[model samples]
Each structure stands twice: as C-alpha cells, then as structure tokens.
Target: MVEFGSPVPEVVEALAAGFVSRELLDWGGVALRLTGVRAVDQPEFGSGRVRWRTATPVVMKGSGRDESGALGPRQAWLLPTEPEWPAYMQGNLRRKAETLGLDPGVELEAVNWIGPKRSFSVGNGLKPGAPVEVELSGPPETLRALWSWGLGQANSGGFGWVSA
Candidate 1:
C-alpha cells in the first residue's frame, strides 16, 4: 500500500528482498509487516484518455457560502455534484503532481455519476466516499501517478483510492 515512484529502486529492492520488515504506516497509526511488494503502474497513454474507478471515496474539502453570499464559518465536505468540484479536485491533483515532481497540467475530463453520492464516516463528520468513474487527460506520467496515488484530498485517509 505504498505510493512510490519507480526511481526509488532502493526501496523496491529492499521490499522485494524482505530486507524491510515491520514499519510504521501513517494511516491511523497502523503497523504492517511486509511479506512482499508488487509494482503496479498505468502504462503511458497514447490517446490522452484514461479511465479510473474510485475504489475508495474521494474527499473534496471546500467551504460554503452563507445565505448573504459571505464565506461560511467552516469548511465542509464537497461532493461530485457540486459546481466547483472539478476545479477543487484539479487543484488537489496538481499539488500532488508538484509534490511528486510530475507535471501539474493534469485535467479531469469528466465524471460519471454511476450512482448516487456515497457517504463515509471519518472520525466524527460524514465524508463523501462514493465509488465513481472518472476520465482524465494529462501526461502519461501524471496519469500514472494519479492512478497509483489515487485522487482528491485526504488520500492518506484512505479516500480516492482508484484503479485504472
């Protein structure tokens, strides 16, 4: 369950050889023992079209506007149906790309509703965790990163885990 680049061969090697054993996984302070490691990455796309399935909920955090058109007091959960969802999600992706040293031009093409929005409880507040289909256009490397790392915010919280 590690989102790492291919250039990190030393980590790959260590994990493959079982030289890396128990380590602290930051997700909820869970500790996992490494039995094996597998490499999975989306291949370079030629058509600039890639499909993704959100295996976990994609967290889109955003603020709300008050009835008088002023910004809300606190940030709240944003759903796929919201008008600004795309831009908000895109910003998250771009930041991730920058962090990963990849191009930040990745664009979210479209999202298929598939079904109604899903709600997943995280800690106390309810978060959107609906499983949906998405299409994106970007550099192959960036797309591969989105595939490997998932999408939207709070990825470390186990949301937005997608599969190509």
Candidate 2:
C-alpha cells in the first residue's frame, strides 16, 4: 500500500498504470498496491527541518576511487549519518523533478536514520530496509513534486516511497 499527505492524481495514475502492466521497466516486479490515501498532520521542525519516513526501504549506492585513482568496482550502501546521504537523495529527487519538467533546486536539510532496521534480498545481495526520517525544507511546489515522485534510488522498484 501507499500513502501521501495529500491527493496526487498524477502519481496515483502513474502507479496504477504500472500496476496494471505488471512492468515498470528496470524497477522489477509489480506487486505494489495503493490501498488508500488519507490526510496526516504535517510535522513542524523548529530548525526548519521536516521529518519524512520511508514506506518502503530506501537503497543507495556510494561510489569511490581505488588507490590507483581508478574507479572502485564496488558500490556501498549509504547510512543516514554519512555526509553523502543527503546529497544522494537530493540528486535523485532533482533528476526526477527535472525529468518531469519541475524545479530541481529543492533543498534537503538533513537525513536521520531511525532504528528498527531490516533488510531484504534483491538479487544476490541483501538490501537494507531501515525506516528513515528526513529534514526537508523547500517550496510547496518542490515539496509536492518530491512527495509524488519519491525520495531515493530505485523509486520505481518501491524504494523511498514516503508520506508526510
């Protein structure tokens, strides 16, 4: 099931289409359902940070270089404490927004990893599925765009789907 702070017809329609087709290109599988959407209280952060929680597990990859200055062959998962987490999420959100012809300058103040972490198998490796709450302060339009599109890598594969 999926939920959002407000109704998003466009996102719902897109999800419905993907569900009916049982294909989402590279996202894999079509076992997702939109049970319903309801209104929720908007969180207020005194520090201009808004909390967000992932409905599905968010998966991210961090790349680095080897000792020889060549690109590393491995991609590592990003924990919330890592400085690269916010940048990674912001980049993905920006890309999605730009693809939909929306503004891509949304600001993600911070990302905090809430506990009760879990993991699931994707192909050969286990992907982490810990619930995350983030601090996002941006324009209403940009916030809406992020809400509709989702927050991190492999959104089509049901990662980083969030509610307010």
What TM-score fits each model? 0.73, 0.64
Model 2 TM-score, 2 decimals = 0.64
Per-residue lDDT tens digits of candidate 2, residues 1-164? 34432225665667555556643233246454444334443333335335678777677766654445567667777655555666777777677667767667667776666546567777688776456777787655666666655677666666777854
lDDT per residue (tens digit) for residues 1-164 in model 1:
55443324464566555534544344457665555556654577767678888877777877676445678778767778776678888888788889888888888888975446778777887887466688889888777766766777776677787753
What's the true lDDT of residue 59 in model 2?
Answer: 71
Off by over 4 Å in 1: 1-36, 66-68, 114-116
Residue pair clashes in candidate 1: 57-129, 57-160
Best by lDDT: 1
Task: Give the worst 10-residue stretch by lDDT in candidate 2.
Answer: 37-46
